[model samples]
Target chain A: EAGVAQSPRYKIIEKRQSVAFWCNPISGHATLYWYQQILGQGPKLLIQFQNNGVVDDSQLPKDRFSAERLKGVDSTLKIQPAKLEDSAVYLCASSLGGTTVRETQYFGPGTRLLVL
Target chain B: DQQVKQNSPSLSVQEGRISILNCDYTNSMFDYFLWYKKYPAEGPTFLISISSIKDKNEDGRFTVFLNKSAKHLSLHIVPSQPGDSAVYFCAASDITSNTGKLIFGQGTTLQVKP
Candidate 1:
């Protein structure tokens, strides 16, 4: 079976510029998530989507970051006025069902973003 | 507050020796824990998991042990192989919250020498 898919494996942008990343989750998966991984650090959850609805986004920076899932399959995460601190790898993951903590999540190759 | 922590930044072991990675969590509410393996330029992959009710869970040559009272966990890989060299992350979840959210540790890089 195919795993989660993400676009633009790498990206570079100047500070204050805007950037967007895309993600396509595994087939039939009911939950999708976006995470940020700074160098030398483990991934941190940014937002979660169950179908077309938002499940959790408490860590998302509302002033600079936003996300949406359309048709409950594809998702996009955007950051405006990117800062140097925002440089990190963006990862997308999916699970069959997110109702339980036991559900294992599969991840994509991830998009590495750098802000100059 | 950093709830989950992997204190060891790195570890090295012989190919035929055992590799043990340690993790500690401050939240007692976390009832489920997991380990993930990651290679350069790739996202983390699920390795093994253990529930609070079980002290140990093993798969193949990998084993996970949870110490609820101590709020600590460890992953053991026996007869480690070169291919096992990667960053290992420990994650925990509070199932009672019903959020399905996972808190991850900083990760430890393990290297197996031939």
Candidate 2:
């Protein structure tokens, strides 16, 4: 079975510029998530989507970051006016269902962003 | 507040030896805990998990022990292998929330020397 897929394994952008990352989750997966991992730190959950509906986004920076999963299969995370502090790896993950605690998440090779 | 924490930033062990990595969480509501292993430039992969009801769970050479009263857990790898060198992260989820959200700790980097 194919795992979660992400695009632009690496990205570089100037401060204040806008950037976007894409994610395509595993087949038949019902839950998708976006996370940010700064250097030397664990991945921080940014947002979660359950079948195109947001389940949680309390940690997301609404002023600069936004994400959407229109069809429930693919997702896109965008950051506008990116700051140096936003330089980090963007990881996408998926699970079979959203209601179960036993669900194991499969992650994709993240998109490493470096804002200069 | 950082609910989960892995105080050790790194650990080195000779191959064929035992490796123990520890984690502590402040939240008592978390009932499920998981361990993930990650290689450089790669996303984390699920390794093992333990529910609060169980004190220990083992799979292959990896074992995870949970102490609910202490709010602590540890992952042990027996006869560590070179391939086991990676960053290990501990994560917890409060099943009562039904949100399926996982809280993760700053990972511990483990190196196995041959």
Candidate 3:
């Protein structure tokens, strides 16, 4: 089985500009997540999608950040009017969500976004 | 709130020694704990994990020890090699019970010398 896939291994954008990152979850995976990792800090969860529905997005900045998983297989995270503080690596992960401890998540190669 | 923390920012060990990485959590609701390894420009790769009920879980040369009373956990890589050098992150999740959110810690960078 293939692993989770993400696009644009690296991204550099100017402040106040817009940027988007895409993620394709593993086959048959039902849960997808987006996280942001800043230098010297742990990853912060941005949003989560269970199938085509949003599970949790409380941490996402609605004023500038938005994400969508239309068909539930692939997802997109967009940041409009990016800020310099938004310069960080965006990671995507997928898991077979259920009531089981065996459901492990697989992560993809993150998109490193640097807002100048 | 910062629920998880890895106090050590970096560790150095010679090859063939035991590499121990530690983590602490403040949340009592976390039932499952996982460790992930990450290289530069890549997302974290799943490593060994231990549930709250179990104190220890071993996989090959990797082992995870959980201390629920102290709310601490550790990852042990025996006979560490150069290939084991990477940033290791400790994460806790409320799986199979409540919310499925993973709270991660600031990664610890391990450098194994040949």
Which of the numbered candidates is closest to the native, going by highest DockQ?
2
Clashing pairs in 1: none
DockQ-best of 1 and 3: 1
Report the alpha-carbon TM-score of model 3 versus the true structure: 0.96
Stretches of model 1 off by over 4 angstroms after superposition: none
Give me candidate 1's interface root-mean-square deviation. 1.0
Q: Model 2, clash count?
A: 0
Clashing pairs in 3: none
Ranking by DockQ: 2, 1, 3
For model 3, the superposed segments whose C-alpha errors exceed 4 Å read B95-97
lDDT string, candidate 3, A25-115, tens digits? 9989999999999999988899988899988898999999999999989999999989999999999999987765356778999999999
Error of 2 at B25 (Å): 0.6
lDDT score, candidate 1: 0.94
TM-score for candidate 2, please give it.
0.98
Reference-based lDDT, each prediction = 0.94, 0.95, 0.92
Report the CAPRI category for model 1.
high
The per-prediction i-RMS, to one decimal, reads 1.0, 0.9, 1.7
